[model samples]
Target: MADPALSPSPQKHLAANDVVSCNKKSIDDAENSRENVAGETALVIDSAAERALCRKFDFRLLPVLAIMVVFAPPFALLGKKIGPSRMLPILMFSFGSFTLLTATTHNFSGIFALRFFLGAAESAFFPLVIFYLTTFYRRNELARRLAIFYAASNIANAFSGLLAFGVFQIKSDLVDYPWRWLFIIEGTLTVLFAIFVFFYLPKSAAEARFLNEEEKSLAYHRIQVDSSSVVNEAFNLRESLQIFKRPSTYGFLLIEIALGVPLQSVALFLPQIVQRIVKNTIQVNLYTVAPNITGAVTLLILAFSSDLLRIRFPFICLGFALTFTGFIIYAAIDDVERQIKLAYYATFMMTWGTSAPSVLLSTWYNNNVAHEGQRLALTSVGVPLANLMGLVASNVFRDQDKPKYAPALITTASFGGFGILVSACLGLYMVFDNKRRDRRQGVKLSARDVPTSRLRDGPKVDDFRWFL
Candidate 1:
């Protein structure tokens, strides 16, 4: 204490410690700054990768819109002859091969030929699937099952946007264009899946390997009793053609015509529609994702509810109403850019409207038709006929109609309104006819009370009640 220099020298010691502390603090700050920069960079990379993946998936699906109106009867007949389990894989493999070959196309003519074959290959898929499901599930159970199947399409629509986004971002030396990669990836996946389905799927419930002898017998019996007029019936073209003689067939086809227009309108031009709200192409693709997802979710909910309630027409009508409202809302708005949120919400309504009706309508007609061959015949025509309306949608949404596309929206809305009217009339007719049968028989027997095995002749039979 007396000799400060010789002693501890507290002030000097404190100063030295302060300098050390300052150095440590500076080092810590520098390390933290570096860590923050690294973290930010990683996050940016992850976000970019995710966007790219989404874009890739989206772009691949656009080719699906270019379907050709090939006659479906031959394929339907083939399905009947070979069974859908085998026929489906063959079709899938053919389409996948064509899709793969499309990647090599250097000119429009080459791509056009591939697209024609692709469309031909896919033409019978939905009709065959509808026919196949009816072979297994009961009428009441069919809607939800179809909903589950159809949900994949809606999800694809959503992912198609993301896929397109992701795929377009692909900068590679291996492939000159991003589209080639899209075709390659989609084709490979389709071929692989086709192979897997070929091995795994049973021709009929009776042939299912997962089932024991008892379960197989039970499944077959269930379909025979409630689903089909004749389980595993032989294909008869003359007999199948007799389905057209029924006035109801004409009515059903008319409804399909109405459904097709709005459906194709939304599906083909959703990107264009979203573009009005979002100026950026990438953002347009991204925005479409939510609406399509919402459509899928809505489709599932309505289908499940329809199943639970054991009704189809009401749900179908509700879907039409939504479509009508969506189109009207969008069309009514003068400045979509000004009210962006509302315009965006209208697109969601449009998706909700179109998704449910397609599934329910298919289920509705299938539920009513007990004969397997006739059911396939009608579906083959009806589904493609609906798809063919895309031509009408394509023409109506002209280049000049830019942003709002008022004329196109109005036309689509008109079709939605027409669907509601047609479905309601048909539903009412079925109800009155059922009542007339009940009065004549002097007994009240609901459609569910009588097994479909008894109603093979459809409306011609006294025991028949329309599965409305």
Candidate 2:
């Protein structure tokens, strides 16, 4: 047995008895520690996996993931060239083109490489956009505005299901394989849309065509007023690392991972699950869109409430709560009839909570961090890090996890529960973090509020607020 007297350091994750163990023992300890993290509440995957998962957001899984890993660094630094505002459209358009072209592939490898290319192109926008938008919007305004952008994705999700179902409905001969047509047509349209976004969208708050000079000034000034960071600040690796001083980042990341499998559970497996219940592939495809549509509406409603109340906790909590109940139904129900009903309801959790977190994390980080470099570097990792959990969730639904996929459902439900707890904890911590900072250094109350909360004084000492 291991020594109980010598406890591991509070900050260090160490084996109780094997501090000086041999190579095998070290490996065992390391494995055990990882298992503990998995069992507890760590984001199970790493950066590359997260980016791959995110990059694959447009395309399918395996091929897109490989491509995204290749493409990530360029997107990470894209702001230096065209800026985040301009880069978003440019990247999206690039991705759309590649995705559309995926129709002509002759083999799996061809599809794989092309999807990879698309992955590279699509990798730049989502995380950075959240960062950019949060700069112009206040914490109160963050979720709703973020939802505006995020809501675009819901359109894609809902439409993709319909498109897939419809395409699959085609007499396989004319389309030459409906699944292939699905890739080709969607990819092509996205490509064209990319061009439109690239040309029309603004470069930043300063340059947005839709905003009047007054609005631009107000937009730029408002964020600077509240956060004490400029729109065009450089990326900071060191300061981003300091975000670890706050545990919420990790907490959010864990939520992202836990939610990953469940969301994917639905995305990757939902149609298949429907097929098990319904005989017609057409019916399966048609039914897929319903949840996303409902989810999109739920998100819009929740987003408005989040902003209206000038609060993050309640809506986020509401999302997880809904998701948890959905998962509970999914897990607990055994009757084929009830299971199918519960499975359809599970979309509420995934479509709503799954998509909102990136927005929340983006808002939370952007609202808090004042250094441009730090914000860039942090968000650069933040979203990809969260999506990385997809790897963990992806593998859970094996062939063995059949019918109800009881194991997967139960596992995802546990994760949703964890997400609820973490969001609660993070919300409380944000309040506490502010109080401690204020008590110790008098930040963000009297004089600090002038620069940090109001943005009227221009950028000052890199102080900012969290979106909570």
Candidate 3:
């Protein structure tokens, strides 16, 4: 009703302001939508990358497993014939040479071939080392010694992570890729170390150059009495095969099956697990270092305690329990980003869980087996059988199970739980069997009560008791 120009001017101003505001809102909404799409695309790309990496790792594992199974027993026999000290050096040198060759390979098939040969070279290294330690250390002393030996691997794992981080940082004019430098460095060091060990290590405790005649005699006598029924016995394939006839051998193998999955899972996928909490690649590698070092420390503690207490299965079970809990906790967490500290802690527990069981389980079987040939036989099968479970690990951590990997976690935990049960049952059976043997003989003779020299027939003798 006022002057047309004045009224219309106010309305027009208000209309223009609304239009401008609407346009600005639309622009902001478009920007936000575009940003969201970009973020989603990044996540998809990350997931696909993770899947590809997992597949590549799985492919690498296949050839190693195949070679290990096919070559382990023959290598065990070879170890026994030549002796661990001498045989180990040859293995070290061969594997190192292969590793060096691996650095030159540009294709997948080349690396695959090298890995197969590398596995062949390393087929008997672990069992031989276990057998080797039994020659020098008594049954009770073996755990801590093996723990120390096993700790080296854990330390190497931690060191490798730190090394990777540092190597990745290196900017060089001569070398284009950091990974090539890693292979060259590791391979050279390994070859050099193998050469040193070949000269340094004694063929047997009896042949040890560092020992006095009396000390050598004492060392040999200690093993003959407590550790081995037949000290430095000749390898007899027929007699060695006798160990497989026992029911306990199968039980031990079952435990190995359970132990291998979790062990390999941590070995293979720990960095990926760490990746959930840490988005940065270098940071993930660094974070893994602490957990591995902690694992080594934990292994030392558990091994020392087990040795002090002179028990094996309890600690092995404890390790399994830790593994089970860690996986369960990690899988149960709905949002790892929010509960990052807890998720990270689970990784520590995973390391703790895996490290001790391997040392203790190896010690367990070695403690019970007194025949040198039989020990090697059992170990050849047992260690490789456990390692073969890497196949299970490699498969279960599928591309579809990316991020949480809930199914893989549950499966691994189930194996751990199964290990706990089997180890406990076997342990209990040992306890009961020992008691029954004690009652039958009318003398409560513990395993230590009898010298292993007379118990060479193993459980066949009436006086023989399980080393519970």
Q: How accurate is candidate 2 locally (lDDT)?
A: 0.59
Ranking by TM-score: 1, 3, 2
Positional deviation of 108 in candidate 1, in angstroms?
Answer: 0.7
How do the residues 1-468 of candidate 2 rate in per-residue lDDT, one tens digit apiece? Answer: 667667556534545334555556756755664454334322232445433422322232112211221154358556644576566656766776777667777788988998787877766556666666555554556676666566656656666666666677777566566777777666676666556555654555556666556555555554554544455665555544565565555666675665555555665676666655676866776776777777767777877776676676656666666766776776676675656666566555556665555455466555556555555666666666555666766677667877667777677777778878877887887677656654543333322233443332222332333456
Worst 10 residues of 1 by lDDT: 61-70
Report clash pairs, candidate 3.
none
Displacement of residue 432 (Cα, Å) in model 1 is 0.4
Candidate with the larger lDDT of 2 and 3? 3
List model 1 lDDT by residue over 1-468, tens digit each.
387667767888899999999978876865564455344323323435333432432232212211211146788778988998788778888899899999999999999999998998888988888788787676777787677677777877777867866887899999888889989988887888778767766788677676667556666666776678899999889988889999999888988999999899889999898878889987888898898999989999999999888888999999999999999999999887689889999999999999999989989988888888889999999999999999999999988998889999999999999999999999999999999997775556566766677667999998788888
- lDDT score, candidate 1: 0.82
In model 2, the Cα lDDT at residue 145 comes to: 65
Q: Write model 3 residue lDDT over 1-468, tens digit each, in one string.
A: 798766668779999999999978876865664454344323223435333432432343222212221187889778998888788878888888888888888899999999999998887888887788788776877787777777777877777777876777777766667687777877887788778777767777677776667556666666776789889998889999889998899999999999999999999999887877898877988889988999999999999999888889999999999999999999999898899999999999999999999989988988888889988899998998988999999999987878888899999999999999999999999999999986665456666666778778888988677887
Task: Give residue 360's lDDT in candidate 2 (0 to 100).
Answer: 56
C-alpha lDDT of all candidate models, in order? 0.82, 0.59, 0.81
